[model samples]
Target: MSIPLALQNEKFANCQESIKILYLVDDNFRCMCDDYNITKENVEFFKQKTEEDFQCRMEYETLSIELEEEILRYIAERTDQ
Candidate 1:
């Protein structure tokens, strides 16, 4: 599936390539449902989804940084041995 330009340029840019497509799909789905202002429940649902996506992105970044650090540490230890 083709990703939306906005998502490709923004939301999915920092994600690992293998997962970028999935994030794009989620983003597009969220955007699609965001245009209607018919009900409180819809707004709440979208809001909750946005918050969840934000949390997931934050966790991914944190884990990526931690993984990089661990890899670097492992390499250093190997070099010193």
Candidate 2:
């Protein structure tokens, strides 16, 4: 299975196995991973744009962080069960 960009972070590097399991079995977690990847890509795209796009980049960055945290929380909750 392909690794999601969100799971490539040091914060989640150790949770690969758990992530794979949850990703396959949980729709919400899967959606969060997809959203995280998309937001991450948007952040990278805006990083190359003009200063006018700085705000947009920052917004995406913030959303990306939120999504990352939510994904982590979900994984933790699931794995603890």
C-alpha local distance difference test of each model:
0.65, 0.85
lDDT of 1 by residue, 42-62 (tens): 677899999999999999999
TM-score of 2: 0.55
Residue 9 accuracy (lDDT) in model 2: 89
Give residue 42's error in model 2 in angstroms.
0.3
Q: Enumerate residue pairs that collide in model 1.
A: none
Root-mean-square deviation of every model: 17.9, 24.4
> C-alpha displacement of 47 in model 2, angstroms?
0.6
Pairs in steric clash, model 2: none
Candidate 2 has an lDDT of 0.85
Compared with the true structure, the alpha-carbon lDDT of candidate 1 equals 0.65
